[model samples]
Target: MDWPTAAVVIVIAVCISLLIIAALAVVVGGKAAKGLKEFDKPTTRHTF
Candidate 1:
């Protein structure tokens, strides 16, 4: 439990947490985009 070793461990832990968060964000965002796309529809106009 030297200072350098503790620092390295802390940094690694932070990096892993950040990676997990990023992955979850991508998954959730993709699902949200898919849901929005499903509700998206094209509009048509009729003219005389």
Candidate 2:
């Protein structure tokens, strides 16, 4: 593809990947917090 088309494709790919990553992070964040809470029952302020 041409430079402009390639640039657009790259940008789209990066955006899509970032969105997927964000979604995954959102999904995992809850579980991670729960795990941290269990791991450190005394104080969750620092880790959570």
Candidate 3:
């Protein structure tokens, strides 16, 4: 492969890997939020 072609392929691979990482983070964060919500206590907010 030419240098330009190789560079493009590398950039594409990096972008894909970044996307996968971001997706995993979102999934893990959601699970954590759900777990914490179960233990959340109800609170009443007074408005002036």
Instruction: For each candidate, give its TM-score against the true structure.
Output: 0.82, 0.66, 0.78
Residue-pair clashes, model 3? 0
Per-residue lDDT, model 2, residue 33, is: 93
- Give one digit per residue, the lDDT tens place, for model 2 in 1-48: 899999999999999999999999998998999887787875655565
lDDT of each: 0.85, 0.89, 0.85
RMSD of candidates 1 onward, in order: 5.3, 5.3, 5.4
lDDT of 3 by residue, 1-48 (tens): 999999999999999999999999999999999866755635422221
Overall local distance difference test of candidate 2: 0.89
Which of the two candidates, 1 or 2, achieves a greater lDDT against the reference? 2
lDDT of 2 at 4: 100
Best by TM-score: 1
Which residue runs does candidate 2 get wrong by more than 4 Å?
36-48
Model 1 lDDT, full chain set: 0.85
Clashing pairs in 2: none
